[model samples]
Target: MQLPLIDLVVFFVYLLGIILFGVSFSFKGRTSNDFQTGGGRLPAWALGMSIFATYVSSISFLALPGNAYQSNWNVFVFGISIPIAAYMAVRYFVPLYRSLRSESAYFYLEERFGPWARTYASVCYLLTQLARMGAIMYLLALPMHALLGWDVGLIIVVTGVSVILYSMLGGIEAVVWTDAVQAVLLIAGAIACIVVIFVSMPEGPAQVFSIAMENQKFSLGSMDLDFTTSTFWMVLVYGLFINLQNFGVDQSYVQRYVSARTDAEAKKSTLLGSLLYIPVSFLFLFIGTALYSFYQANPENLPAELQLSGNADKVFPHFIASELPLGLTGLLIASVFAAGMSTVSTSINSSATLLLSDHYQRYINPQISEKQSLRFLRIASLTMGGLSVLVGLAFNGVSSALEAWWALSSIFSGGILGLFFLGLILNKTKKPNVIPAMIVGVLAIAWVSLSPVLFSEGSIFRSQLHTNMTIVVGTMTIFLLGFLFTWLVQKENGKPIKSSSD
Candidate 1:
């Protein structure tokens, strides 16, 4: 496959560095709580960077540029919505969630709603997290498969094991610190690749910029006020809601903050992560555009097999294999690995916490001791990691990693977030309204799945709307229905409304 030798060396160095960092931290984490949540003493800065690293997974590092190569830069607007969500999380969500001093974010769902609500959210989270971890493993294996001729299964195993080892050993403290390290490596690799691409090009940055402009990749328009046919409204509303749900409502993010020593520290970490994400994400998207320019300038450089796919999603990795110098190639591979490991580790720890705190502890045995809980946490972590790898291998034909994740995310985010929001904002309910609301929401989403039948043979919206977008819209509709039903029921009862737990 002609992978670069020096690149391999540098890449291994990065991997070794990550492992060493985790190992160094492992000794300090002798207890279950210490491993899982760093004993709630994470430095705000480390926590912030960990948030970015964990959030920007292998998909963002490697898959995103590949997707951008095919779709143009319109997708970059997704970053624009991040800051707004960050503000909401730091100012509101993190503070409240941290105040609960709970190990699992799902506990808040249990506290405000009910045990049923907590169970539902935790199950949804476990499903979503497992799917995401699998996708990350599958996608991350692609470059290795294409470049080094490695078996995809072996690649997945190696990737999954590496993450589990560190996460199991070092706990949340190691995850955050290593995540910070991974975050730096991840961005460094991207910037290095971009710089190398710029250097390799004949006409340099100016020419590349000119080509991107000509291709209309820099534009984020369609402010034409049509939610059905325009990216503007979709990007604004969908992006904002998705981001809010992810950071504000989801346990993955909440786990990061909950590890912090104080609410203020958690808020700082969130705000810092949010602000840094804007520029970092922009650079990653720019790498994709730069890649498009690179391929345009030298079409023959691409492998013949890739051209048959007739898709640009294959371009980014192809460049890494054929164009990059040996040392740089290694760094790029390490960078992608770092990205994948950072995310998988976070997911493993978070999922284990959910199982332990919300499921195993709450239901299986409330009397379980901390040492036993720790043992269960490790088992849960390994179990979830294994499940994700299996699921990833099972779903092999998916086209774009980013799209698959977004599609899966849209499936549960709206309903879960809706429940959380209701618990927070709509203080009128004491009964288990969220359960019915979620049931109604899930059913409504199921009904919206039938929208394809409603469309006539000549409908243009079919071409305009992606299936993922359709799911999100359907989920949103369900959330609103749940809200409306709850409100109507509350009004009929005519009792004075109670306040939120806040």
Candidate 2:
């Protein structure tokens, strides 16, 4: 299954070029302000593309198609929820971020809810990003394993080193610019994949449609008003909540807002990133459907194991390795790498930024010099990158990258997203009111996320609600409890209610 010589060259060239290219920015990142915010000089469109690339990580690049091929378009509804989430982010979150004096995403959390809230949110962010980096690393390795027969662990280490080095050298400037370029590569590669699939079918391109229709592959899942499964409504709720967390409170995104030249540009960047993904996501899903038809008509093309439901993730990579022409195969491989690089670089840089702004600079050394800060940022990025590599190795046999990420994300995201909403909705929710609500929210999240392992599978005490509801349930639980407590305290003290959301 190893790639031919030509394909190998293309892949290696991209890897080497990106590292050298990013390292060229070492001088730019030597200073504190330049490293973190790039003087707020980047144009809107490039920032938008970087945001989109962050959204469409390699996990999405590979797993979206796999999900479509395995069943139907049920997951596509997640994309459908983006605009809704983006609207709220642009309308509310963007301006809030633009007004920040520091690039730290959790600064406002501390200002509003005290150091406890900021620390909790930052810790959750770091964990979530680590899980995210791990998933993307694993997904990036999957194809290389199928194509080059390389050990997945080796590929992850090599890839992680490359991304981490670039983040160290380039800072925010390098991440944003490379992300813009890599985003284009991913989109273009996806289109190329769909085209090849359409042309490869013996029955011609129209067969893609007929085959999709026959299997109900275009379904958005059952439209039933159910929360016990990944029904259309449930996924929309999940997507909205997750997207809100990402666009609203996530550090990676908050850094982008701080880096943008203007508030309007930042808002537009969010809109463009969200809107652009709709069609791009469609392309990936369609590629999967077309792949289903391509392989269905040529059953012998796919191995018997890959035909199993659990092996869907392998199909797309297997196809890229075995089916595409020589140069094109290299390009698509580069695309997967591009997707991974764009996201990993962004996360490593942003995570380091958070570490510096929220913890090291704030606690350990408030007066550290730019040169010292630069050194610290690089060391932090390297440490986190290594941790992520270990996490990726831990996912040695997962059936679906997307599934694993969804669960891991819920555990960390619920607290911040819920707490953020509570602060926004009930301005009177003081730091004292938050401690109990957060305690309850954490317990609720832990119960929902770990119930299957904690309780017997058939136990009625286990959470029967779909896992997609983890964020939604945790968020509402915190918000509701916090609000009730706030109101109760206000009434008991005989204080006049003067809280306003804005």
Best by lDDT: 2
Give residue 283's error in model 1 in angstroms: 0.8
Q: What residue runs in model 2 are displaced by over 4 Å at the alpha carbon?
A: 397-404, 428-432
Candidate 1: stretches off by over 4 Å: 228-230, 304-310, 397-406, 447-465, 470-479, 496-502
Clashing pairs in 1: 6-327, 7-326, 7-327, 7-330
- Each model's TM-score, in the order given? 0.91, 0.96
Q: What Cα-based lDDT does every candidate model obtain?
A: 0.77, 0.86
lDDT of 1 by residue, 291-347 (tens): 878777877787677666445656777777778776778777788788889889899
Write one digit per residue (lDDT tens) for candidate 2, span 252-324.
8888887889998988888887789899989999988899999988999999999886888789998998889
| Model 1 root-mean-square deviation | 2.9
